[model samples]
Every structure is written in structure tokens, then in C-alpha cells.
Target: MNFTHPSIRAQIVSILTAWGMPKHLTDITAEIMVETDLMGVDSHGISMLMAYEEMLKLGQLRIAGEPRVVRDFAATALVDGADGLGHPAAAMGMRVAIEKARQFGIGAVGVVNSHHFGAAGYYARMASSAGLIGLVTSSTRGILMVPTRAAEPVLGTNPIAFAAPAGPGHKPVVLDMATTTVAGNKVKVYHLNDKTLPEGWVQDEGGRPVTDSRVAMDYVFKKKEGGITPVGGPEHLGGHKGYGLALMAHILGGTMVGASFSPIRNRTQKPDDPNNIGHFMMAIDPRAYRDMEEYTTDLDAVIDVLHGAAPADPAKPVLLPGEPEEMMREKRLAHGIPMPQSLIDHVRAIAGRAGVAYELKET
Candidate 1:
């Protein structure tokens, strides 16, 4: 099915409001979800409505809770999300960071006890919009990532994002990605479509390769006997790079925010358990080092050079990290977001349970 951005966001807001979310929160959550779709991040978009609804039903997500200041320093702060949705909590944290950066040239915030934030890029882009360099990282419950030389799942598919201002007519230098080869959300999408996963994404219970989505998830979440591998397939292929990145995210995100780390924080053991996911955000004022315009111009020049680089395969061209996503977002926004029938049904079911009205756009 196809749905316009505004229409989809309105439906999400109304349903969340009916589920007892505050007006402000409903707005922010809806905006975040819609923006995920806008940026071609189907995994974190409206497809997550069912997960949010289930969390609310289990009382794992609080509607009226507000973040509390756990600690504060001159240009840094630690926030406890109080078991609130991550969108609002992260937004609040970034707002504080932005304000501090404006005043002191740099600011950082750490958050714990938060639910899944839609997309890391969304938060970093928020900082870029304010003309400041942005950095974001997050740690979550064990999902589909596997540790090197180990069969069982031990790490979350931790992700990091960074964004900075750019020259005129160019989008910000935004890069967002998971340390793992793929995220659990992408696995969920494959499962919904009844498709097998590509090799290297997951392994069977005994550390053998597997392609069945259902079996892969069972190994990762249920049996806990096997899991998704790091970006590099095995020990020799730079898999350690992805491992190092995941560990860095844990330290910066989980440890810094006083949340559980690695095995201790796996939420799959207790699906309804309140998530103590942690996040880190930093904002830097562009004027701190050099002229803002010159910096942006240099950034644009570098991007242009990278774009013109020769490709190993003539059929494919060299591309910058954020360029393809920028083009996809523009196309999807104009054409309408494509959603599967099952996801549409999921949203309708939620609306019915919440006593909210909804209408789907024709495909």
C-alpha cells in the first residue's frame, strides 16, 4: 500500500494519543516515525507500530513519564529516561546539548532507561539543522548480532551516527549505520515477507550458517545459541573492525549512561522487561575551529572527489555514504511511502483496539 507522509503521520499521532500518550509526545513520535520512512529507513518506520503497541500493552512504556537529571556538569549532563519512549527523551537530551553548545562551544548528553529511538540519524540531523556538528550512539538489548568466534548472541546491533553542516544546495554530511552486517529490524522485515536471509547475516544454533529468517531469529533470541555475525564474515575479513565499533558503542552508550552491557542487558530473556537502552549525543559549534563557510566548502569538495572516484565494477559507480539515501528520500517523499499489506493490517488492528479511526491510501 502507498501512504502519503502527512496522512500516515496523522494516523500514528491519533492512535498514540488514544493509547494515552501526551499530545506533545504523540506529535514527536509520529514525526520521528514518518521521518524514518522519509529517509528510506523502512526498518524503523511505521512498520514498528505493532511493537510499540505491544510495549504499551505490557506496561513497559510509560506515557506520562518525564526524564530526570541524574547528573550535571558545565557542558554535559546525564538523563534518566524514566522508562519513557526514546524519541522524546533523546530529543530533550539533544535540545539541552544544542543549547549548551551554543553557549560553551560543545555539549554532550547521555541517557538511560529508554525505549527504542526510531533512528540515530534523526537525532544527529537535528543537531546539524542547528548549524552544529552532531554525534549519536545507542545500545540496545541483544538482537541479531553475533560475537566473533562465538556461537551465541552476546551483543546488540549497536549503531552510531554523525552529521555536520555542508555547502549550499548540498545536504548535511550525515552517516548512520549499525555495527553489525544488518539490524534485527531488517530481519523482521524479511520474516514479514517470508523470505530467507542472505548468507553471513545469521547462523544456526551450532554456529553453522543459516538462511531461514525464522530459524535465524530463534537462534539469536530464543535458543540464544547462535546469532548474526559482524560486518566481516569471519576472523580474517575485518570482522574485528565491526566488533571494535560495537564495543565502543557499549562503552559510550551503555556504560556512560549506567545501563546494562552485553549479556546482562539482553531484553529478549524478558520481552516485557523495561529496556535500559542508553544513548550518547554530542554537539559541536562550527565556529570553534575555523570559518564555518570554509569548512563546509571543503566538505563539499571532498564529497565531490569521492563521488567522481572510479568504481571497481563499471556497472556500479562510486557513491558517498549519504548520497544514495538523500536521493531515495526525495523520490519516496514525492511518490508516497511503500508499505506492505501486513504492516497496513497491523496499524489497522492497533487503531481498532485503541478506538481510533484510520484510512489507508490506495497503492
Candidate 2:
């Protein structure tokens, strides 16, 4: 089924407002979700409504709360998310960092007490839109991945993203990826899409590989056992690098931000207690380093050369880091966004539970 972006966003806003989320926050959340869907990141799109709804019901997520600044500095700061949805806090942090970067060469913001914040690239793109380099990363609460040489899941699928503004006629260079071989939520997307999971993407609780998407979803979300593998499958293939990256994200987003780790904190069982996830955002101003025009012109040359390179397959053109997503966004904007019937059903279920109107059309 294909749905108009405006229609989806409107329904989301209505549902969120009815569920007690402030109007401004709901608008932000809806924009992020719709933008994510337009970029073809189905895992972070409307499909996540169910998870957010569940988090709200459990009282782990809230709205209309102000983020408390824990540390204030010129180029660096930390903010407590006030146990709310991660979108608003992360977005605000990026804005603050951009403000600082306008004067300073770089700025960084750390956020704690946040919940899942959809796609990290969204925040990075925010900085890129402001003509600055951007970095966004987040750490989750529970053990969600099997580390190298480990028999059990002991790390979250910590994610990292970076975006840099490009010169005229070029799209920003945006890269977003999970430390794990694949993001856990992607398994849910695959299941709903009726697609098969590839090998080495997931493992059983006891460290065995599993290729079925449905089974992987159960292991990760149901807390049954083993979960995602590191960026590399096993020790020989560079799984250690992925494991190290996960820890690096945990250190910045989890440790430095004062968020609770799955292995360290047990405050999640009760309703109203926060999951205490954390996020990190950094922005860099190109003009602070050199002349902005010169830097951008050089970047455009680099993109030109990249595009001129010979393709391994003539039918498929070589693409830059963010080109595919840009193409997807363009395509989606013209033709309506595609939604799996299963996802539409799930979104309707969320609306039903919230007692809000579902104003969507499927064809």
C-alpha cells in the first residue's frame, strides 16, 4: 500500500497528541518518522509506532518535559532527556551544538535519560542542512548483541551516523550504521515485508547462527536469548572491530552521558522509571577551518571524480555514501511511500489503542 506523506504525518500527529504528547513534540516526531520513511529506512519509519506506543504505556517515555542541562559549556554540554521520547532532546542538542559551532570550530552535546530516537541520520542531516559536519550516535539499555568470542548477548547494537554538507549540485555525505552486523529493528521490517534474513546477521542465545528473520526478531525483542552479530560475523572476519566500535559508542553515549547500561543498571522493570538511554551529537563548522567556498568547491570536485569512476556493472551507476538515500527520497516524494499491509495494520492498531482517528489510504 502506498500512502501520502502528509496523510501519514497528520495521522501520526493526531495520534500522538491524543496520547498526551505535546503538539510541538508530536510535530517533530511526525516529521522525523515521515522523513525516515521517505528515505527508505523502513526500520525507523512508521513501523516503529508500535514500539513507541509500548514504551509510553510502560511509562518509560513521556512528553512536554523540559530537558535539564547537567553541564554547561561554550563548546560542550550535557542534557538530561527528562525520560521523554529521544527525538526532541536529540534535536535540541544538535541545534545547540550547531549554535556553538558557528563560532567555535566544533561543538558536542551529550544526552542522557532518552529513549529510542529513530534514525541517527536525521540529527546528522540537521547539521548538514546548517552547512556543518554532523555526528550522531546512541546507546540502548539492554544487552542486545553477542560480542566476539562471547556465548551470550552482552552489548547493544549501538549505532553511529555522520553527515557532511556537499558543494553545489551535490548531496550531503551521510553515513548511518549499527555496530552490529544489522540493526535489530531491521529484522522486524524484514518479517513484516515477508523477506528472508541473510546468513550471519543474527545468532541464537547460545551463540549459534540463525537465518530466519522471525526467529531473530523473537530473540532480540522477546528477550529469549542470543541476538545480532557484530559488524563482522566471527573472529576471523573482523568481528573484533565491530565489538570495539560498540564499546566506543557505549563509552560516548552510555558512559560519558551518564546513561545506565544494561549490565550496570536494573531500573527498567517498573513503570514510570526511565530506560535511561543516552545519545551523542557533534557539529563542525567548515568555515572555522578554512574558506567555506574553497572547501565546498573541493568537495564538489571529489564527488565529480567519484561519479566518473567506472562501474563494476554498467547497468548500475556508482554511488556516493548518501546518494542512494537521496535517490530514495526523491522517488518516494514523487510516488507515494510504500507501506506493507502488515505495517498499516499495526499502525491502525496503535491508533485503535489510543482512540484516535486513522486517516490513511492504501491502494
Candidate 3:
């Protein structure tokens, strides 16, 4: 099913509102979800509704609370998500950080007691759009990543995102990635699309790679023995570096914010207990260091140099970090976003349960 972006956003808003989410939060979340799809992050877009619906029904995701500041300092702060959806709180945290950066040259904010936020890049872009450098990271509730030489999984995907503006007439540099080799949601994407899991993506109890999509899903989400590898496939291949990066992200995003570590929390908490996820958002003003024209001109020249570099493959040119997403956004806007019929039916089922009208029209 191909749907216009606006239609997708409307359907998301309708279902969220039906589920009793406040209009303002629903609007913010819906826009983020739609933009994630437009940016070609299929794993994090509408597909996430399935997980959210389960959380909603289980009473783990609250629909009534808004984000509130818990602590504030000169250039750093802590935000409470009020045990609600992560989108609004994450958005608020970035906004606050941006404002602080304008005053102090650098700002950092942490969000706690939040549920799964959509693509981190969306929040990073928010800072970039305001002409500041943005850095983002989050701790996950699922224990899907296995550390190097570990027999079982202990870490979540633990994504890290960074974005920086290139002044005018140039796209910002945006890098959003999971410390693990692939995000756990990408496995769900593969399962939904009936695609095979590539080698090195998932491993079994003995650390042998699991290439079968269904088995990989079971290992990552259900059985939970050996799971997704760190960024570098194996210990000999620098997987330890990926493991280190995951810890760094968790330290800043989770521990720093006083959020529960999933592995420890799950041992005592019930199935319906809130995940207590945490997020880190930071912004830095380049103007504090140099003139805007000098910074942007140099950055643009660097980008031009890379763009002019010789490609190893003739068909694939050298592209910047955020170029692919920008290109995808343009393409999706022009052509329409495509989704599997199964996903459409799944969303419709959710709408039925939520008592919302299924009005996602095809483009």
C-alpha cells in the first residue's frame, strides 16, 4: 500500500488520539513518525505502532502525562517523561537544550522514564535546523546486543545520533546508528518483509550466526540467548570497540539520567512495569568558536571535496552522512511511501481495537 505522507500522519494522529493521547503530543509524535518514514527509516516509522499498541494495552505506556523538568542548572538539566511516550519528552529535551546552547554556548539534557522514541535523527535534525550541533543517544529496554566473548546478551541496541548544520545552501551532516551491527528493529523489518537475515547479524547460543529470519527473531526477542553482534562482527574483528561504544552510550543516556538498566530491572520488575528508558540530548553553538561564514564555507568546501572524490564503484558516488536520507525524503515525497499489505492490516487491527477509524488512504 502506497500512501501520501499526510495520510499516514493523519492515521497515526487518529489512532493515537483514540488511544487517549493528548492532541499536542499526538501531533508531535505523528509528525516525527511520518518524517521518519519520509527519511526511509522503515524500521522505526509506522511499524513501531505494533509495539506501542501492546505497551498501551499492557498499561506500560501512559497517555496522560506530559514531560516536565526535574532539575535545571546553568547549562544542563534533567527531564521527566512522566512515564509517557518518548516522542514529546525527547522533543522537549532537544528544544530546551537548543535554548540553553543559545545562552551558554553548550547545553545538555537528559530524559528519564520514557518509552521508545522514534528515530533519533529527527530530534538531532531539530537542533541542526536551529543551526546548532546536536548529539543524541538512548538506552533501550530490550537486551539484544551481546558483548564480545559473552555467552548471552546484556546490552540493548543503544543508538547514537549526531547532526551538524553546514550553514546555508548545504544539508546538515546527520549520523544516526545503533552501536550494534544492526538495530533489533531491522530484524523485525526483515521478518515483516519475508527477507533472510544476513550473516553476522544474529548469533545463536554458541555464537554461530543465525541467518534464518524467524530463528533470528526468536533469539533476539524471545529466547534471548545469543543475539545481535556489536558493530564489528566478532572479537577478532574489533567487536570489542562496538561493545565499548554501547557502554559509553548507556553511561551517558541511561546511567547518567538515573534510568534503570534493563537487564537488572527485568530481574525484579513485572512484565507490565515501565521500562524506565533514558535519553541524552546535547547541543553546541558553533558561533561560540568562529564566524558563521568561515565555519560554513569551510564545511561546504570539505563536503565538496568528498563529493568530488573518486568512487570505488562507478554507479555509487561518494555521499555524505545525511545525503541518502535527504535523497530518500525527496523520492518518497514525490512517489509516496510504500508499506506491505500486512502492515496496513496490522495498523487497521490496532485502529479497530482503539475504536479509531481506519482512514489511511492510498496515494
Per-model TM-score on C-alpha atoms: 0.93, 0.96, 0.98
lDDT, model 3, position 345: 86
lDDT of 2 by residue, 1-363 (tens): 789889989888888888888887888888998999999998988888888888787877776566767787989989888888888888888988898898788989999989888899999999999999999888986577787788887889899999999888788999988889888889899899888888888888677777787777888784687788889776656688888888999899889988888766764366667788999999999998899999999998988899899999999998988778889999988888898889889988888888987888643
As for TM-score, the candidate ahead, 1 or 2, is: 2
Can you tell me which runs of candidate 2 are displaced by over 4 Å? Answer: 267-271
Which pairs clash inside model 1? none
Q: Where does candidate 2 have its weakest 10-residue lDDT segment?
A: 263-272
Please provide the root mean square deviation of candidate 3 (C-alpha atoms, Å).
1.1
lDDT of 1 by residue, 1-363 (tens): 678898889888888888788888888888998998888888898888877787888887886667777888989998888887888888888888898899889999999988788889899998999999999999886656666777666778898999988888877888998888877788777776678999888877676788898776677555657777787764646677787788898899889788777476553546567878899989999888889989888988987888788899999888766666788889888888888777788888888999989765653
Clashes of each: 0, 1, 0
Rank by TM-score, descending? 3, 2, 1
Model 1's alpha-carbon lDDT is 0.82
lDDT of 2 at 294: 94
